[model samples]
Target chain A: MNKRRAARRRGLAASDDVMWSLMQAAHAVESQLEEALAQVELSGAKLAALTQLVEAGEPVALGELAARCACVRSNITQLVDRLEADKLVRRVDDAADRRSLRAAITPLGRERQAAGAKKVDEVRRKLGKALGAIDHAALKRALSDLD
Target chain B: MNKRRAARRRGLAASDDVMWSLMQAAHAVESQLEEALAQVELSGAKLAALTQLVEAGEPVALGELAARCACVRSNITQLVDRLEADKLVRRVDDAADRRSLRAAITPLGRERQAAGAKKVDEVRRKLGKALGAIDHAALKRALSDLD
Candidate 1:
């Protein structure tokens, strides 16, 4: 907290301060990650989707993609559209569900994802080192609690 | 890491996986905090502003608010505008700098912030306990390095 800003306090609540700190910390982490990702012209959302596809090992239905990403179907559609525009992803009709569409990563998309992954890995190692052997299971549980 | 999702993998990049995990973790934390704040009809942005105002101990200019929140001036303007409409904040022209506006939290705003703070504290404590202790200096250094 900046000293000048500290002077403006009227009736500060402790819990709010804690919450604020958590958010600020999260923001700090995100901004750093975004800057790193910007080098590859990828946003976190785009990277997240690509990562999902890469991890999925095969073509995934668009609706399944949305569910996996914890985002809405419409948002997934828009994301896929952008990815397709970037030539990072392609939409193929689902053979099993004609009503649904499958999104598969293009070769170029995989390459981009690989490069982005390397950069992100560097950032994450730095974060992990900073956070220090973070209890990932605990974090996962807490996150699930939130969902 | 669901097997179903993992089965779709081409060849998971270590860094990409780490980055994705961090983001998912952060998103989980944010969603949890947001849900708690939402109970009082306060979005994360609004709660952040309110928390900053309460912490400031006095009226704060928009620029200062933006700095504390690590957001853009335009975003701060919009957030304050909404906060003012909710009667949670009142804008006062800075006597020293007429061009800048100061936002003061109203009594209602204080109350809401207080309520938000309580819930936030509970969540933080739970999360902190779960995450274990994070090295403040290392984390701050890492965040600053990324910035």
Candidate 2:
């Protein structure tokens, strides 16, 4: 016996159900966010990238952006390519390290990112209110523990 | 403002974070379980199908098994083919519905499922105890509200 199966047989609670429900809920929310961002031609990953750029207040190295997104370097390359093609971002050679490149959000990207962020903010608020009605403290505690 | 994103921004207890954590945890558990199951030549999905068949105690239709597994019928077909090749499961003609085929877990499949389930149960218990320090009801409630 490893771990989860033991928990299931003991009937402490259906660990599988707990885990599955969590995945399902996350997937549902992610799908909803993707749909919401579609109008702005952004995926959740793209939106998250833009947000990172906004908070940085300056162009960040491609590697740094990828790390923040928790995605692969190749994936970041594709994401940056799409954003750059849309004129929402630009990749410039790093002045300090010529071999390294930095990604900067364009003025247009800033406006678009701001607009999309408002929508994201609204969605988060509703989720908070609903979760607050349940067990807000517990949820917060779990997240804090993970970090 | 879609529902989830707003809640995330508010920094109000985020069901999203809880959900993400749960998923990450589950993936970790699954990877561990698979490491053991690999010795028996079974993947998680195959093991799940075998378990379902054992629980049914009779031939189970492919479509029904697919639904139970939350997978597409085509995926089930491929899985069944692999299982059949391994002689762990077999496809039998449905007497009532010739158009459909019933999948039956062989004696070997049942034994494998039991052993796998036991190991999985064990791992799950440890996981539950580890997470026991956290509030699960709060997590469940927050996840439920998302629906």
Candidate 3:
């Protein structure tokens, strides 16, 4: 029984190592991207919000924006306030629900989002070159499966 | 020339899609881990600091800690203050450098670090299961190469 348990522990450790490596890689990539975004007066959070809005192709419910940003509703409100102040996004009354609000990207927001996306692509391209040996198709397949 | 530019744009977009997917995957995994760490009263930043100390196996200078944590010196000071308040870590004058202070983990800190590591491992295991179809060895190789 002790031997069996030891074997199981070893297996778990190996698995943990892989997960740790992935986390480190993600953190490194994010740190680099954050620095890049900062040059444009954008943060990872703001970029994420803008990215969601652009992808949404229309105003999204405030609650849905919060969900997509993986942030609390109050935090999303503050974020939207900043974005609105920058004239990158605007809030509108929900047509279907009079009491609710939605966030839509303004033309300026779209322009900024495009610029941000370009920066992200540049950074990601560098990362891809760095990890060029990896099978990107396989990686994409795996990530898609997770979703 | 226009056709070539359009084709290149298409290629870049496809590449961007793959990169975006990876970012989303990483975000999902990190969010889950952050939630798990919160149950132990540890934010991702604090946990990162603790992990660094544990790995160093000795006291780490405040400036070095800031660099490792990817924050400013003042930020590290505040973070260390919180950790000290919790009695998980302490600050001591650097023996090698009298002008500097170093942060070290206490017995409680070590215990907490172990607990945090366990929680991280558990969450990572779940992520692994979610991406069970991926070639983990290849993924590890790719990430390690990045470093």
Query: Relative to the true structure, how large is the alpha-carbon lDDT of every model?
Result: 0.69, 0.69, 0.73
Candidate 1 CAPRI level = incorrect
DockQ for the candidate 2 complex? 0.20
A39-87 per-residue lDDT for model 1 (tens digits): 9988877887898898888988988888877678999999999999999
| lDDT per residue (tens digit) for residues A12-105 in model 2 | 2344444444544565666666677787777777777887788778999999888766678898899999999889999999989988999999
TM-score of model number 3: 0.73
Q: Estimate the overall C-alpha local distance difference test score of candidate 1.
A: 0.69
Q: Across residues B93-121, which tens digit of lDDT does each residue of candidate 1 receive? A: 89898798999999999999989877766
Give the per-residue lDDT digits (tens) of candidate 3, residues A24-55: 56667778888888888777778778878877
lDDT of 3 at A141: 66
Better of 2 and 3 by lDDT: 3
Per-model DockQ against the true two-chain complex: 0.22, 0.20, 0.22
Tens digit per residue, CA lDDT, model 2, B94-116: 98988999998888888888777
Between 2 and 3, whose DockQ is larger?
Answer: 3
Residue A17 displacement in candidate 1 (angstroms) = 9.6
